[model samples]
Target: MQRNQIIRTRLGWTLLDGVERLVSALWPARFKGSVGRVLLLPAVLLIGILVIGLGYMIEYSFHELDLSTYRLKDEYSLVNYAVIADRPVYMRVLNRTLLAALIVSVTTVFLAFPYAYMLVRTRSALTRKFLLIALFLPFFIGQVVRAYGWLIILGKQGLINSLLEGLGLPTLNLIYNYPSVIFGLIQYMLPFAILLIVPAVAAISEDVELASEGLGANWISTFRYIVLPLARPGLIGAFVVVFTLTLTDFAMPEILGGGTTDFIASAIYDSFFQLSNAGLGAALSMILVMIGSVIVAAIFYLAGTGTLGVREQSR
Candidate 1:
């Protein structure tokens, strides 16, 4: 009985292999190279839908909104954009958004670098596991939940203030301000920055650092000259990602800013929902997209878009 079972199992394996080869032979040669492209169809369709929506936005942006009927005018013009240009308030919001994005991106990168380096270079298994858990734990929580958590910690009667009061110190007001908003954004973006940097840091060979050190270079010198230059792609990638995310962030500024420090996204929200001016809102949305695109384009031009581990071929 055992000999018969072994023979049957071997025969079944041979038949399965034959069927697989037969199927492969029947598949057209022209279509074999397109398997990856076929997998990308879903992404292409998503982008197509987004482009169609953007087209509608562009059409709406050219028309003026009639406040009386709350309808868009049939006549197309640059009135919506003109309004943005003429109003100092719009420019101020844009400026604030840009400044906040710059601050958050720079700060996040500065803070994430050491964490990422340690995560990749650490020898202790326990330390690496701790770092990974800390890095990814926030991702399990939604951004809104985290923002609200910050409120619980930073609010007037929140934990920090409660602790201060217990210690016989004056309770401080910490939430609902520009600095608080920036602080929230930095905390939210740190994990992303570190994630982007880890792969780059990991890609760096330890032998290169050892070679530098053997050549009478100290650890600091090796890090500055060898490690940093090699990790440039990851650093640039993290900066761009955090900057773009911070620029368009709506919740942090809304929740932590206390309606006083509004970003561009807030202004856009007000135009559409509060004022019921779709044309103006569409215009604002387009402007925001353009601003983000231009900044990203400039970064790609300067940094060469090698952020995805693609290195230029050396001569």
Candidate 2:
């Protein structure tokens, strides 16, 4: 009986020891995590600053204003929002903004993808270096300068028209419309998309290509199935970059859109500068903020849920 008691006691001690070890592992003896010192803290601070700015804008958007004093009036009113809601012109401008964003984004990706592919796949070192430098060259120049360069190229009687006329062909009017805005936007945003996609294309394994070849797959088939799937993150990233830039870009649309092709940004500028309507301008800015918020939220949700894998499967 004494021996039985000792064995039971030893087993109980062993069980208790294991429980203690597990508890220690799960909840450490020392709490080492500094929540304030997390890597995301700086990002949180930056986001907080932006949120505060947006909050102030939202607050300003809700009030009436006295243009003489340049101060807000008492009593919150929805008059600004009502003005936007009643105006078909505002809605048209919003639609134009979305359409231009879509066009520029799609064009940028389509053009950049092949160029980036060649940059990575080509074996020529000088060619690769030159392409990279050329891609980044526009960024070194200011946006205003680049826009002016496009103005020179696409303006009435510009180089393209001159060339066509020299060839005895009728001159085409490409500027002062949607096409000019899209052209300038693509030129401005292409670098971002190319940079985002090139790394993914470069990172593709040679062994994977070889394996696909061994399976009787041709180059096209291999690229379609094996390569695209692996590079999906980069592609998605590029699309997001292009889409967001085109959606928010003010310079291209302002300079190239002319009066008839007024977008939300141009509308906001007109309200502020021409009309001197700060409240109205704030309201328009708020509207853009809401639209941008929706887009960003949708992108985040799609990225979080991994629904962006459609890019590879569609191919």
Candidate 3:
């Protein structure tokens, strides 16, 4: 029995060795460091698709749409871009989008920081769990659903108005305005800002804050000096994300702005679908992309590459 067992073990070892040799032969030393590259293949493919789509858009932008035939002109020109430059409505929409983006980014960050700080610094497990639930609950709900929910709550004959009527107060006009759009955007973006900031806040050492307190620094002082500087990367990241998203937002402006406070996205939609002007829409899209890229580049330049986790080497 022992001899039979020993023979079986030797056979197993031989099979394993052969399998290893086969794997090594199939995957040579030159390809050993390619696992990460393999993992990145899907992302590269996605980016390639995006680039191809952008190329089509660029081509479309160069051609004028024939209103009579509802087709693009054979010749390429800058007539679509020229219309945007000459039209005041396009510039107005662009300006509104930019302003909304700035407001939403700043407001979201300000509101999110305190919530994130509490979530990270709380000693009670229940409080932490509650905070996490509140933060993530909105994420599961679709943005359109939430936007509609706001319409229900803030509509002229909605809950708030009903309550005001009960109390003999005038019903306020809450929805379908620029403020309402900004309000909805801030609500939608708050969770994202908190999520980005929490990691940065958690990375801060409790001992550092305690030491600052021991050295006679007040809580406000410690927070302002220590926490703010350390958590800047997350703040900048959240700001960039919120700003870009708000800048290109379609739903909030469409649903809440009620066509009166049209953003650039609304104009783009009208150009493509409502007006059947693909060339104009493509030009607007390219402009939006350029504006977003420039703003993001400016942020990286002003805030440094640290926001992207690339630290500068010491001199």
Candidate 4:
């Protein structure tokens, strides 16, 4: 017994020493705020680049465009904005884009939440591995390839239509519509949502969940009161990612939206590249940047305030 105790003590000390060394190796050498600023210099420069680009766009948006020469005038004018406001078509497209983004974010959160919960909470090792691979598989595939795949799947007389025809049912029109756009956006955005939720869900200790169950709480109550709160951060992260992706989606809409549809990204592309209306394009690009900024701010506020979901760590 004495020998066994000695062995255990040695093992513990060795493990602790190894952990100390690992921690020393992993931790930043210094965490002084000034030192931290040095680390952030690269990030700062990247942000500066983005800000300067967007600033130029904003400046150009306010400049008068010489119609004949397609050159910008020095004078400031709200004519670009006025043009945007006067057109009901652009307003309608903007509203639809907002709605589409909201719907995609909400759907992705709901679908990925349950999947992430299952992945982390389930005991089956194979199941966990399977889900992890599936969640990340789309990342390996190029975005254009994924969009093209969707185009094939949703195209008229494609897989779904062929299946329906084989079963003697009428071929449904799935392509070139809102449904196609939503379907493509959801697939494109799901991986991000899943990745964000998995970490938060994994952070939830099993003991807390068991304690809730032991206290006479049903599965639904346990999830509502325990699991959901702990996974709030992940949900917030996922929502922000999915929402931003949806807002900036250009490929899916272009491939599946047919000719009639017009997303803000597509409109900007048309203005800048197609029509050579750089000023209008710049204005539209600025609008996109502003929309992205508003969303990022809102997500930060919601996550910081713990309004979006339950905070698991504090509990």
Candidate 5:
């Protein structure tokens, strides 16, 4: 027993000594904040690059597209912006994208809340393992592949239709519609909402919940009064993230919209690729950035900026 204890003591000391040496070699413990900032230098550089690229796009958006040469005009004008403002098509696409994003965010949150709550509140190890697998399994599947899977399931002669035909029923027009796009988006966004919300749900103390129950508070009251408010930040975060993602999504609408239903992303792609109008695409890209920024800013403004974990308030 003594020999075993001695060996264990030596092992612990060795691990501690190794950790100390590694820390000394990597960064000074005395200047933790400075070391952290140094570690984030690469991220700062990347942000700088993004800012520079946006500046170039903003410059391009002010110029006209020369269709003959397929290049931007040397003289600056707001012709591209004017086109966007004058055309009802652009506004319609933007409005549709925004509405779809809002719907997807809300639907995902509603469906995810109960699932996330169950995942966090369950006591069974088997339940946790199963829930985790369900949560993370889709991550292995690419977004485009998931969208295509829906195609096979919801197509005119796909799985559902095949089954329906076998039963002597007519096939429904499931794909290439607004509802199909929204449904595909909801399925794609559900896992993200649950992942974002699980941490907040888990953060609630079971002891506090029990105490609330003891105080004559029913489950509904306890959740409404105690749990809902605490989970608001995470929910807001998930909503904003999902909103931005859906607003800027390209694959779902392109693959499923079936030529008629076009989101702003598809609009931009058509501008850039189909028409070979880089200037018009740049203008649309700028508008998208501005709209997305307004949404994120609105979320931060209402939620007090903690929702995104931004430390701007410390300044």
Candidate 6:
């Protein structure tokens, strides 16, 4: 540590320090927070624009579609919300979306945890590189392409079917079902779950774990009490991400569902594009956003925001 400090002193980074001075001089001490607020203007501006768009959509959701005029009615009513409430199809689709999101989030987290643990804990550079490569290779392919790839592999007369035919055996039907849609969601979500979890696992000190073991804690006990609690933040974060993405996903379910299953996103598409019911589509979109917001709020209420790296008063 002493030697490293000496090296740091020898390389004083004079040019970078001069640039820092130049920047500091540009924003005088009297205008400190003002300059920082100016720098934040673009992001705040974009958020304001988004809030405005949401306002428009909220207005749209309350208006009725005038089919004769092929435009939204200027008069506002509770018709859209009433339709959503009275229609059982909307509830069914919403429930299916919620179920799928829940299952995909849980399954992806379960599969990702061990992978993240191994990736973070391993010391070998080559092993880490290899794992990273394997994990990211699928990302180069687009989600639609990946879903279609599953179709080709899981369809009749595909690779597995061909193998079964060669073996003079019956082939299994694989794709285009509720489970198949969930499988695709799981595949798409696994890497994201692992990426979110790695930081949490990495934050844990191996020395602390070792000390626990030294105190006569078994592997299961240590994991249940120490690792799980410490990693709850990341786990909840991954759950929220995967759940929202799956809840709003259009492509995977649309491609893999074989017309037998439909998530709420697909229903929204049908409402707007296929049926030309813009009012209903707006209502559905708002519903989707509300559902997502509620889930995130519930997660925060239960787990707090430490998973998101917010400053803790105690920490």
Backbone clash count for every predicted candidate, in the order shown: 0, 0, 0, 2, 0, 0
- Residue runs of model 1 more than 4 Å from their true location after superposition: 1-26, 312-315
- Least lDDT summed over 10 consecutive residues: which range in candidate 1? 306-315
Top candidate (TM-score): 1
Candidate 5 C-alpha lDDT tens digits along 30-99:
7877977888999999999999999998998899988789889999999999999999999999999999
Report the lDDT tens digits of candidate 6 across residue range 201-225: 8888998789889999999999998
Residue 272 alpha-carbon offset, candidate 6, angstroms: 1.3
Local lDDT at 283 for model 5 = 98
Candidate 5 — worst ten consecutive residues by lDDT sum? 306-315
Local distance difference test scores for all models = 0.94, 0.83, 0.93, 0.84, 0.90, 0.89
Question: Model 3, stretches more than 4 Å misplaced?
Answer: 1-30, 312-315
* CA RMSD of each candidate after superposition: 2.3, 12.2, 4.0, 6.6, 3.5, 4.9
Q: For candidate 5, report its TM-score.
A: 0.89
Native-referenced Cα lDDT, model 1? 0.94
- Could you give me the TM-score of model 1 versus the true structure? 0.92
How close to the true structure is residue 257 of candidate 1, measured as C-alpha lDDT?
Answer: 85
Candidate achieving higher TM-score, 1 or 4: 1
Q: How accurate is candidate 4 locally (lDDT)?
A: 0.84
Tell me which of candidates 2 and 3 scores higher on TM-score.
Answer: 3
lDDT (Cα, tens digit) per residue for candidate 1, span 1-315: 999999999999999999988978987677889889989999999999999999999999999998788899999999999999999999999999999999999999999999999999999999999999999999999888998999999999999999999999999979888999999999999999999999899989999899999999999999999999889999999999999999999999998888989999999999999999999999999999999999999998888867656777322
Candidate 4, residues 1-315, lDDT tens digits: the string is 999999999999999999988876776556434676789899999999998987888898997678888888878998888877888977877777888899999999999998988988889999989998998899999888987887677668688888889999998888788878888889888888988898889888999999999999999999999998778878988988888888878887888887556688888888888877778888877788788889889778856866344554364
Clashes of 3: 0
> Residues 1-315, candidate 3, lDDT per residue (tens digit)?
999999999999999999999998998878989978999999999999999999999999999999889999989999999999999989999999999999999999999999999999999999999999999999999999999999999998999999999999999999889999999999999999999999888888899899999999999999899889888989999999999999999999888878889989989999999999999999999999999999999999999888844476222
* lDDT: the better of candidates 3 and 4: 3
